[model samples]
Target: MSELDDPVGSSLHGPHAALARRVGRTATYPADVATFCAVPADPAPQDWADLARLVGPGGLADLFTAPGTPPPDWTPEFAMPGRQLVAPVPTGDVDPRVVELGRDDDPAMLQLATATRPGPFFARTARLGTFLGVRDGGELLAMAGQRLHPGGWVEISAVCTAERARGQGLAAVLVAAQVARTAADGGRAFLHVVDTNAGARALYARLGFTQRRPVLFRGFRVPG
Candidate 1:
């Protein structure tokens, strides 16, 4: 069977396509197009052109890439850019203060994520996968989660810390824990962040992640 036929790869792609369709979006693969309702009703012509440019003249292979972003070197013809945010979880053992958030039903977790722009999607994705967090006393401070698992690759996402909790290294610690867990389970970690967020980029770099590529997300209004 071809790599695309692999169960893990197929499952990952299916979920992504489903989510996209629900939002009116469409993704193109070498063999087929995955259409999602998530795509905007009135997509700008440039949006389509950008998608074409990112996928290249030949079209996509096994992966997906947002337009205006470069594909990662390790990925094939279709490259998704924006560096995979990765960092080394502290060595030896997972910190006791860090905890794995089991489900989004927890009101506190939802509230914490809602404070950020990407949090809502992060919350939704976490429901389909796993989420990890760190706390001080009873308050949730920093958190991260898993997304887009194709083959041995797992994307680290929804990483955030409370606004008042900055400078405490809580984000670093939380990411480290997630990476360590992924590595232990024999999976590689990756993530996406807005290219303009220099501070967040620096933090990821300090933890040992390097820029893999740039990615873009153009949101359009869905026609009613």
Candidate 2:
């Protein structure tokens, strides 16, 4: 076995797997505690093989890992180099544009997400955690919210602004608010971004989010 195949991806496993086991409702192949089937982070060779089989060839599976290197077999359609950034809660009031988003806001959220393509926003994705958004008049224009909860870390995900809403600083405010929320909880705020999105990476840096480590956003094919 190659060194890359060693059982190394463990940051999001162990106790964190319990979250996927408990709330990864979309999980299919194995919903049991020992083998949740949403997205596997840093899986072992046997476990990785099992998940790939579960996804099937030509199908897709997402894997998140702390950056170093990856095995050749687990190729992704898109690979994003991610950073786990933490910030201090704002010393002043949170951005008022950041509005609390809940289940009732699903219609607008889904619509905006579909147009912006900020990763997967499932029908029941609002159940993940607290989500916030900014609306123009009545239309949802910008949004950001939580995704994964590994240990005390809450991932801020689905951050996007409508094309028409760009340059109004909506995305920045929304992200800052989310980080503030996460910080208030005594947990750190983290996010995954495509390495190619230098603009977004720069914005995160301006917000005092220092790079903790590199993580990979992988998408693999599951055969039909």
What C-alpha lDDT values do all the predictions have? 0.54, 0.63
Cα displacement (Å) at residue 13, model 2: 5.9
The best candidate in terms of TM-score: 2
Q: TM per model?
A: 0.63, 0.74
lDDT of candidate 1 vs native?
0.54
Q: After superposing candidate 1, which stretches have Cα over 4 Å from the reference? A: 1-92, 118-123
Off by over 4 Å in 2: 1-45, 66-76
Query: lDDT per residue, candidate 2, 1-224, as tens digits?
Result: 21122112222343244344322212321222112134333445555455555555665555444222224655557766655555555555688778998777988887887898877676656556789999878888999988666566777878889999898889889988888888788877777677777877887887777766565666655444
Residue-level lDDT for 66 in candidate 1: 28
Cα lDDT tens digits for candidate 1, 21-71: 221133433222221111122445544444444344554323233222222
> Candidate 2, overall lDDT?
0.63
Any idea how many clashes model 1 has?
A: 18
